[model samples]
Target: MKMVSYLVRHHLKMELRSLHNVMSLVIFALASTYTALQVLGGKPDPTTWNALAWIILMFTAFNSASRVLPEDLTAVRAYMHWTVPPRVMIIARTLHQSIIMIILSCLLLFALGLFLGSGNMDTLSIFGFLAGMILTAVGLASTLTLLSALSARAGAGYGLTAVLGLPLIIPIVMISTSFGTDLVTGVALGQTVQNLYYLGGLSIAIGIYGYILFPYLWRS
Candidate 1:
């Protein structure tokens, strides 16, 4: 628990301090916000809004996660290697990406529904959106971080990471979109519950795969 907290704090500090990461995420957020406003007009359908949000969030996560491993290079990696356990580093970095994903998801949701006139949004639906976003982002972010780090050692690192992660993110988008449908419409109680369960279950599977695979990827 102590180690996990330390890893999370350390990575969080680095994220806050890093100009590159901040700038990239800000740019991504701006783009996402703009797109969200244009697409989700007043009283947009829940299915449509959810799909849009998922795309926006996924792209933003992809852009932001593209840099985590490359950001460190030799010195930082070496320092972390000697100071912290690999598992600690992985968990901490995963948490950092998860935070970014959630923040971006919430920001986009607000800008679209509030300013752009999404009549479909209610307090509970917004909560549901947040819930769905967290599940999708956490899994996507950790998996991307692990894969990107592995690819970082290759010449086509960024390209390879893109190839690997983009396809994997599709399921996240679908699950989140389903969850959003429930939130936006608020009609089918059982359907929404089922969608949320499926999304959660998918996230768990991906998260487990990433956690199990990350250490091996880290060494390679």
Candidate 2:
């Protein structure tokens, strides 16, 4: 537990110290949102708004999370292998990506609302919207972090990460979109709970798989 916390903090600090990633994220988000607005030519409907937001987020996540294990990290990884367990490394990276994605999601949502116009959201619906965003971010982080590790091992770059990650992340995107739609439409609480359960279950399963499989990749 302590090791995981330490590793997480270490990665978090590294991320904070490096402005490149954050700058890229903000630029991409803004550019994407601007393009979306130009294409729509006006405020998009709730469904279009939700879909565009997710598309932006998915690509942003791929861009950021794919770099979690850069090609140049071999030396750093070697030192980490001696000091930290594989599970710790994977979990810490995943957690760091999740935090970054969550922040990005919030910023993206604000931007979407500002330009695209957020649909009418009551307190309960707002809760659901935020919950869906967080869960989707976690699921995306877990799935992409593992895929990024695998791609890094193969000497593949961000392109390959997108290739491998997009198909796998579709279910998460679908679930999150559905959850967001429910929130916008004011679906029954029970239905919302069921969707949340699916998202949470998927996230946990992916996290467990990444934790268990990462050690083998680490050894490789």
TM-score of each: 0.84, 0.92
**Clash list (residue pairs), candidate 1:** 42-117, 43-119
Cα lDDT, all candidates: 0.70, 0.82
Report the lDDT of model 2 for residue 71: 24
lDDT of 2 by residue, 93-191 (tens): 889889988988888888887888876667677667777888898999999998888888777766788898989999989988888887766675556
Clashing pairs in 2: none
Off by over 4 Å in 2: 68-72, 188-190
Candidate 1 weakest ten by summed lDDT: 37-46
Q: Pairing residues by index, what is the TM-score of model 1?
A: 0.84
Model 2 residue 4 distance off true place after TM-score fit, in angstroms: 1.4
Winner by lDDT: 2
